[model samples]
Target: MAMTNRDRGGKALELLREGLSPYVERELRRFLGPNVEAEAARLIGEDRYNAGKQLSDLDVAALLKVMWESWNDVFRKTLGFAERSLVSELREWRNQWAHRLRCGQNLSLSDSDPQGLLVKPEVARRQREEEQQTVPAPTGVTSSAATGVTSYAGGESSSPTPAGAPSTTAAPLKRFHGSVALSPLRLGAEAGRIAEEVLAHLSSLPGAQVSVTLEIHVAVPDGVPDQVVRVVMENCRTLKFAVHSFERD
Candidate 1:
């Protein structure tokens, strides 16, 4: 006898889980390491969920939310192309399931093409290049003595001297400051993490002192707030440093 719709769906889900098993296992290993798999197997059980419970009316919305969050976490933590490829595949599967749920149809979790999920090394490299390009370069403090105008790279007015005053050579290029404002969602730990990452990038420049100040705003996650984040680096002899800041929402 042919299998019922529920039975077929259950089998499809089983196949889907089986197909995803290797990728999930790989991610778990990377996140928790090789020993973690043994612990996970022991704790979560080798079986996926009870077959009878798998076909019930699941909250697809909540499932999608959790899957997206998991994908982001994995993307942030995993470093190489292989790991990223696994994440992409998982995300695609999640999207397919979400579309099926939206159409008010049941989905069979069957395995699809795994290679299509893996990101090509060249593609990953280009993505990194694009990301690097998007970040604005740090603007250095340009003095009127150097450019004959009281304007910095960002077009902000620097300290102006008298029109007839004798201009001396730029004051030995002492330090550089890059100011930024944070969004409401970028408070506490998120702000701290960004500060640390920015500092790390700044510190890579030769003879640069990295110092960051957070400007708190009264407003939260709406329009741009009144506060600003000022990052100051002292004794920067070379002009190689880049400043990048982001507001999280």
Candidate 2:
């Protein structure tokens, strides 16, 4: 008989635990100090600490979450945006396994492409370059400090300075704002595609300090199962969704 999705998921989970355990422990010890378990407990949980005082005792989500939480402090300088994206993708896959374990459903193999999800750093950088090349620059934008006017597409808006008044046309704004609102992502493929587009956009931005925030509002009817909620909320927490609550009349 062929292995069920649940069995495959279990095997994958086992591999992740065994493969990541020693590396996770070593990194934590190096940065977090000799009492790795004690420090990790503060983030993962006290119960987990008491269970075995090691990363191997925890699940894949816990291990990935630890790396995410410590990324800025330790891993940021060492790893780049591609690595960050991989960690985020791994967290999503781990949560998918969590859902499969509970519902025994067939996994969507298309959404979980190994080539895309496990993209090498050099390939990601090259893709970023290609995406940047394809993005069109803003056109017909011109600013004149002399007349205090900004022109776009042959249309001019004037901010005529009073006699002897100083011109501020060249001054940069205090903040720059840009946003893209995606359609409601229901399927794994939809979410993954949108995520890749957003990453490409971010890669094209000018600065390294660009802050990105993801807001997800899960809308489910009253009859939704506890397992579904558990899995959704687990991924939400993994991604650090700001507010989690039921909104209904």
Write the residue-wise lDDT of candidate 1 on 1-249 in tens digits. Answer: 666543454355555555655555566566666564344434333223321222122222222222233443443464554554444444445444423333555443223422222223343345445765887534564445665656555456645567999875544445666666665653533453444446545676889877765443344466443344332222221433454344565
TM-scores vs. true structure, each candidate: 0.27, 0.39
Error of 1 at 199 (Å): 1.3
10 residues in a row with least lDDT, candidate 1: 50-59
Error of 2 at 105 (Å): 8.6
Off by over 4 Å in 2: 45-52, 101-249
Predictions: Cα RMSD each: 19.8, 20.0
In angstroms, the error of model 2 at 122 is 42
User: Per-residue lDDT for 1-249 in model 2, tens only?
Assistant: 677665576577678767987777777777878667776776565433234545666766678777766665556657787887888777766655543324555433333333312223344345445765887534446667787667655374556678889866644323334455566533333444445545544555676345666666565666668787798789878977787755454
Number of residue pairs clashing in candidate 2, backbone atoms closer than 3 angstroms, sequence gap of 3 or more or interchain = 0
